[model samples]
Target chain A: MDTAMLIEKSALVLLLFLISLGVAAYQTYFERKLAAWIQDRVGPDRAGPFGILQPIADGTKMFLKEDFIPAKADKWLFIIGPGISMFTALITSSVIPWGTNLNLFGRDISLQVADFNIGILFVFGVVSIGVYGIMIGGWASNNKYSLYGAIRASSQMISYELAMGISAITIVMLTGSLSLNDIVKSQHGMNWNIFYQPLAFFIFFITSLAELNRAPFDLPECESELIGGYHTEYSSMKLGLYLFSEYTSMFVSSAIMAVMFFGGYNVPGMDAFSGNILAILSIAAFALKIFLIIFVIMWIRWTIPRFRFDQLMHLGWKVLIPVAIVNMLITGLVVAWNQGWM
Target chain B: MSLQMISVILGSLTIASGLMVVLSKHPIRSVIYLVITFFFISAMYILMNAQFLAIVNMIVYAGAIMVLFLFVLMLLNLNKEMEPETTRMSLFTAVIAGGTLFLVMITALRDTFQYGKGYVQVPVQDAGLVEQLGKLLFSKYLVPFEISSILFIAAMVGAVLLAKREKQIID
Candidate 1:
């Protein structure tokens, strides 16, 4: 509204974007290290200590390489595909409550970029469009495998989104609000929604894995079948953006899970500690929760193998959606019973 | 003044993109332009404080429906431009239909609005919110909602059945 307010909001927006990028960058490093540890081998020790700077090296290589577009490809669309992926991935985190409000210089600073009313819907909406990146990218490549990969990717999204949306309905039903901030606030100390909606949490977690294209659900990029998948024709930084956006979406989904179910920024007896001190500590708590979730995601990636395409579809449509619906009905009944309506 | 200016920009972009949707030779390009137009329309909805409608528009139309369109278009393998030659009768019919639609739209706009007051000054309180919408639907529009869902289920079942290849029936 005012100049100071504009500046503060802009600052928060920039800070959030940088944090997403930074975390996504480090995620690559961490995933590789974790994968190596899973296989009982030392990995990427050349760049920095224990390959900590491996991501930086990989990034530089991507940037300095020759950018090539296939001769028959739609040039503009090819370029914009990864851009769309990166943009959507980065923007989805804007509504996630990073921490509580802070008091500084006689001004209260909200940690989130912008706390929209329908925060969960905003994430879902952006996430649904994420498939366009893979779809258009593969189509623009003019390669058959790329097209097949894109088709698989989009169909997979279309299938899982039903279960994902239904699962979120249970959350929204339990919280009685669509805003992530309200969702987080409702879980003050130990009253997280996961305690009440365990089934929804499980359904949501699996859908999130499929949504992020992490291992066990990475059907679109199944290397055995479709080599390089959607980005088979893409080279240089464009491919890098595709890879980076995956990790970014992974981090964002992890953050979303942390906020929605894991009591984001809320520690036990956190209400007792008030003021800026509490706010700072809450931020740390939120980050720690996010990192733990991301670690678990990587663990899942390495430990479990990918599912067959039919099995993936069956799980999403038959198992998860029905379970989510039953979960929602039971949650509604419980809430009604609590309110003496039953 | 600022809101009106932003609306004007968004409105022009929507129209331009809509035009591009038709004018683009490639079907995929048309789909992309339509998606762009939808985004602009969603932005206008947000400007009107209809955040739920805005995000739902993005989710349903730009996200899900457009992806379906892309999949179908790609499957048809119609990537090359279609060069349809316009005949005299066809051109005349097109012009007549376009003229009639344009006149109807202009008349409707002129009849419905009192210039700026109609769209800007009047605020729609809680109209676009989920809770308000849900309560209204469940109360006043319950029958229609249920019926529509049943209709969707029917259509889905019909599609699945129709998609299956038939086996010969032995009488």
Candidate 2:
């Protein structure tokens, strides 16, 4: 690679890393503000112009707090726990195609950090690895409640992941390629996959929510029963990392949902835009879709109560998995018929 | 000296972790080591230009199967104190067995190797591995695929039966 290309890619990676951290931090503030609004109260309006600086305040609080390691905890594993959570959450975005290639200084630069052909599968693999952070953190905490929470989180994520994978399979069958960019391209103009594969979309949407362990599927961190759940013993920035990773996964999931189903960055009349304006418009379109999805997630979090553990497992195995498989079969048949292979 | 040397270094780390899987005292630690081993294997698969297989390896082995093993280990409470120290003779026997296995693998690999002949460079295609695997499953390997389904069904039934606890008759 040329020096400029190397520098560009490095800059892109750094930008994405910073953006993800900022998004995660602000997502926490957003959730709090939304929760406040829902409950008919003013959120952190005092913290720098309608709580724009709330995330900064939160960060300061977490950093200044005393870092406490539990006496019974495994120190090395404890440190590694949050590190794994944050790393996995951050790295999963590398394969996601944020927008089409942008031309800069006579070089075409892809918005994504990496574009592996098996992008969707890479996502599934990375998401599964994310379970280790919670599991290890819980195990290292040496608290029974944390251990229980960890087990719940692991099993729940694993079960929901199968349904999530199957849902992605339906999309793959429709698109005929595993690359996220190809999937996005296939959904150009009004040709979004959601129109043809609504069932698959619903299954994927719900399963993604479950996979992220947001409200109604947030059994792992159910405060009523498990007493702060997996990260009960974690204090200061270690705790912040766990919480930040949760919101980061939510943001990433929202972005994935938007890109996969909502015709990512593809406005209805986007073809009419010219030159630099087109690029900026497309990026704005993508950002808007992502924010909308994130808002919907926050809405659901405030709307629904957590499910019972057994009920959560039943939804994954008996309901979502079967629905996902049926969607896949139907999608496959449709694709085959359209291609005259049937 | 190049990316190949970096891969070689990674491969050695993987092999070391794989060895640690058996050598570790705690079962949980062994499971962790095995997970790391799977990760290393996945990295090697990436090096071999099999990104799909590498991701699948991580998803299935390091992610799903290892999580199950960890769950079982945790459920059984097989932590540090539960691990028993190996006797000298058992250790000697393990070493012998490991040595024999290594020798057999090396010899077999050496004997089966064909160097710098009948190798053709083909243009890389973007046909997702899943698509090719699906085609193979439905065509050339249909019978084996069907048989595997039967095996899976049997395994499911066996699992349900095994998990069903016996109830006492109330008088």
Candidate 3:
């Protein structure tokens, strides 16, 4: 690659990494505020200007707190666990197309980092590896609650992944290419995948919730029984890393949902604009979609109760998988029919 | 030249981690080593521009299968004290089996080197891309692909059957 391209990519990567971290930090604040609003109580107003500075305060507190490890905890794995969690969480954002191309310095700069041919699969691969974080953390802690939580997490993720992949396959089939940019381009001018494949979108949305370990599917860290679940023995920034990774994954998943089911950055009559204005507006539009999705996710988290472990497993295996497969078959028939395969 | 250097580096790392999988005393550690080996192997695939295969390899082996292996090992809690003593007969059988496998690998390597370049290379351009792979799978290798999918389904059914508990008739 040329020096300019290399520099562009590195800059984009750095920018994306910072954006993910920033979004995650603020997601925690929004989550608390939303939860408080849902429960009819005043949320944090002590921090600067409507508690906008709360995330910073929380972050500083996490850093300054005692970084404790249990006596029986496996030292290296304990450290590696949260690192893996945070790493996997952050890296999945690389493939998502955040906006349209911008023309700068006689060059067209794409807003995506690496537009790999197998972009969606890359996300899937990272997500599958995400389980190791909780598993290793729980196992390393040598605590029963942690182990139980880890086991629950791995099983839940594995079970939901089958349905999730199947649901995503419908979109892949529709797009006829694995590239996220292609998927977004195909949905130009408000022809979102959600309109055509609502069932698939439903399955994908539910499965994403399961994959993110958010309520009402959060059986892994059910506090009433497991007491903070996998991170029960964790403290300080070690705990902070785990929580941060969760919100980061939430951000990434919301982005994926927006890109896939929503029209990504494509608004009706968006073709009217061109160049830098287009790129900036598209980025703003994409960001708006992502925030809306995040709001709905948090709304569900506060509104719905956690599922029973068996109920979660049942929904994943018996309900979601079958529905996804049938939806995929119907989509296949439609695609084939459209292509004169009948 | 740099691609070759990267391939060589990844190849050696894969072998080293593969060796550690067997050499590690702890089962969980062995699984971790196996995952490392898988990562190196997938990196090699990426180096070859086999992006589709690389990610699928990651999703399947390092992601799904190894997670289950780690899960089982963690639950088993098999420490040194819990490890069963290796019998003489078992050791003898293991040695013989390992020796036979080594001989087979040696023969395979010898034949590969004799008939072709010392290193393997994918002959077709963009053969590792999803589009090319999909076309090839549907056209040239359709029967084998179908048969393998069938075999997978059979294996999945067998697993479910094995795991299902028989219903009890309570007196």
Candidate 4:
């Protein structure tokens, strides 16, 4: 690899890291603001102009507060849990294409950190590893509540992931490629996959909510029964890490949903724009779509209540999985028919 | 140089974690070590240009199976196993069994590594891709592929049958 390529990749990685952190921080503020708005109450406004700086203040408090560890807790695992959560959440961005490649210094520069051929598979694998953080942290806390939350979180994620993968298979079958870039590129003009695979998109949306532990699928850390769920024993920045990872996952999942379903970086008259202008506009368009999806996720969180554990499991397996399988078969037939194979 | 260095690191870590899985007294610790071992194996698969296998290894084994292992271990509540009294006879038996297993593994691996052409290092181009693998599996290995699907169906039915309530089973 040339120095310029290495530097470019590193720069993209760094940029993504900063963007994820910033989004996560602001996500907390937005969630609270939205929550208050829904409830007809004023949210934090003292910090900086309608609580713009609230996240910074909240972050400072998390860092300054005393880091607490339970006497019976396993020290090493407890410490490692939140770190793993944040790490997996952030690294997922590496495979996600931010926008089309841009030309700079007479060279083609990719916007993504790493454009692996198995980008979607990489995402699935990384998402699966995220369960370890919650499970380990919960187990380490030596709290019954924590353990219960951890178990719930692990089971729920695994259950939903199957449906999620099956639903995504329809898209993969439609596109005939696993690379996110290829998936996005195939949807040029007004030919988005969501229009073609609406059922798959529905399943994906619900599964994404479950995967992120957002309500009504947020049984992992349901405050009513599990008392903060897996992060019950976490305090200070450790707790912050857990919360930060949640929003980071939210951001990542929103991006995935937008890219897969909502014609990522696409606009109606995008073809009319010149090449370089289109690239810049695409990035902006991608960001706008991501935030819009993020807003919808938070809207659901406030609008809906948490599902009972059994109800969550039943929805995931009995309902979604079967529906996803049927969708997959339908997609396969359609693709085959379109290709004149049948 | 960097690639080789990464390989060396992953290789040693894999062996170490594999050893830890057996040596650790805590089952959860062992499971963690086993997961680490699986991750290193996946990394090695990536090194060999088997990216599909690498990701699948992580997804299936490290991600899914290991989480189940962890869940079961947590439910059992076995933080530490009761240390079996180390009798001299048992120690001697263990040493003999361990030595024999080690020797067998080493001999088998040695032959496997150099048998067909002294460790062919050429990476198969796009051999690990989904399209390439799918074509080969659906055409060349169609029978086995279909058989595996049938096997999976049988296994699923068996699982459901076994998990039925005792009253249901008796009925």
Query: Across all candidates, what is each one's fraction of true contacts kept?
Result: 0.92, 0.81, 0.92, 0.88
List the candidate 4 regions with Cα displacement exceeding 4 Å.
Answer: B2-6, B81-100, B113-120, B165-171
Against the true chain A, what TM-score does chain A of candidate 4 give? 0.98
How large an RMSD does model 3 have?
Answer: 1.4
lDDT of 2 by residue, B1-171 (tens): 565576769878998998899888668778889999999988877666667778999999999999999998878877667677889999999999989999999887676564433222222553336667678679999999999999999999988777664442231
* Model 3 agreement with the true structure over B1-171: per-residue lDDT tens digits: 676677777888999999999998878889999998999989988877798999999999999999999999999998989888999999999999999999999999889888877354754768899998989999999999999999999999998877664642221
C-alpha lDDT of residue A118 in model 3:
91
Query: lDDT per residue, candidate 1, A289-334, as tens digits?
Result: 9999999999999999899999998998889999999988888898
Candidates in descending TM-score order: 3, 4, 1, 2
Best candidate, lDDT: 3
DockQ of each: 0.88, 0.80, 0.94, 0.91
Between prediction 1 and prediction 2, the one with superior DockQ is 1
Which digits, one per residue and each the tens of the lDDT, describe model 4 over residues A9-80?
Answer: 888888899999999999999999999999999998999889899999999999999999999998989999
Answer with 2 or 4, whichever has the higher lDDT.
Answer: 4
Worst 10 residues of 1 chain A by lDDT: A167-176
What lDDT would candidate 1 get against the real structure?
A: 0.89
In candidate 4, what are the lDDT values of residues B1-171, reduced to their tens digit? 666677778888999999999998778889999999999999898887888999999999999999999999899887435555789999999999999999999999988876755333536787877888889999999999999999999999998878886769679
DockQ winner: 3
Q: Order the candidates by DockQ, highest first — what do you get?
A: 3, 4, 1, 2
Global lDDT scores for all candidate models: 0.89, 0.86, 0.93, 0.90
